[model samples]
Target: MGRIKPQTLLLQSKKKKGPTRISGTTILTCNLVVGLIVLSLVATYRQWSNRSRSQAEDGLQNLEDTDAVKDLKKFDLPSYAILNTSKGFVFVELHKEASPEIVDKFLDLCQKGYFKGMSFHRVIKNYVIQGGDDIQGLGAAEDWIMKGKPHSELAVSPKHEAFMLGTSKAKGGSKEFDLFITTAPILDLSDKLIVFGRVIKGQDVVQEIEEVDTDEHYRPKSTIGIINITLKQEI
Candidate 1:
């Protein structure tokens, strides 16, 4: 081949160098774009993680503020009332959490011997055994309403099961001192009665009281008096 010209060789060298410079510049630009994309994705993930963590913490705090949690904390200790009846003694578990005002009034009456010698005048077979009237009469009503302004709203709605103790409202809109223990489940009366306690022991005594002979007005033929009432607390 003929000897190449210096000018031609120089032109060819310049063409190769131009392409190399362009390739290097393109590679650097691509690397910068990829780096920026990776940085943006990492920042977005971190923000989402932080937000999720904050929401979870707020949800936990809200759960702690619920009424159920407060009730659980308040009723850590158990409270009860012991009814010494002429037939036998019956143990009652007070539902202070469900009806605080009613329970307090019942406990106060018990401490003051208000229930002593009060006979179980009304006895309905398979229904209820009611007492708490100072007089041995059946229809005579006593003031069961808390004396001053009520400490809380009237808990006329019951939330108790069988063998629960409750009071009735008199015709004059005031609660009566007459109290009753259910011999069976009574859901219909829940809206009208105020439940304060439930029988935890000596249910047989209640059964015996229920089996007593009754007169035309469902009054017990023989006296079944409340000898005394006492309170207890368990930690």
Candidate 2:
């Protein structure tokens, strides 16, 4: 047997397998990176899912609103609106037969509680008391201008008389949202306005509203809000 040199034995003993040994810290760091990537993917998926669900809900709401408007337009039964104002309650008898579209618009607004907390923006002594200005942070966003809106432009209709509830007489012609109660007969309006209801009760309340202090622009100085408007179907 040949005897090996000490140096040769030492070199053979020092030779490694040529593979890098993994430390616990390195393994833990790799695992944490993989876990972070997984968590990020999960979070993104959930966010996208939530956004899709919200979009679907909004689309459904729009479709239902369209159906509701259709139902309101075809309404024929006599209805009444009891407007609970800041000062007092005012009763109005809706003339559905005379102005079906206009009356239905009013009814739709009432049903949606759109008039709650609305202020009387315009007040004219012995002229009219107006409310439903989009000023209460309510307006165009309400889908007010639908695809098939009839009589979008302002034009006059018959039956403008005292105590009548109808559209505004000026610019932004009410769009079925802005409304006024006539204190006296106003026939000088060349622009078309609607008269959908007649004041059946609370004439004094109407008078008080009309007589309230107003700025030069006819806007009420103090808040005269419509607490709420309730509608009832007449048999």
Candidate 1 residue pairs in backbone clash: none
Give the top-scoring candidate (TM-score): 1
TM-score of each: 0.55, 0.54
Question: What digit string (tens of lDDT, one per residue) describes model 2 on residues 142-183?
Answer: 222132123333234445467888864343435547877877
| Model 2 Cα shift for residue 182 (angstroms) | 0.5
lDDT for model 2, please: 0.72
RMSD of each: 12.7, 15.6
Off by over 4 Å in 1: 1-78, 134-160, 171-176
> How accurate locally, in lDDT, is each candidate?
0.73, 0.72
User: Which residue pairs clash in candidate 2?
Assistant: 155-192, 156-192
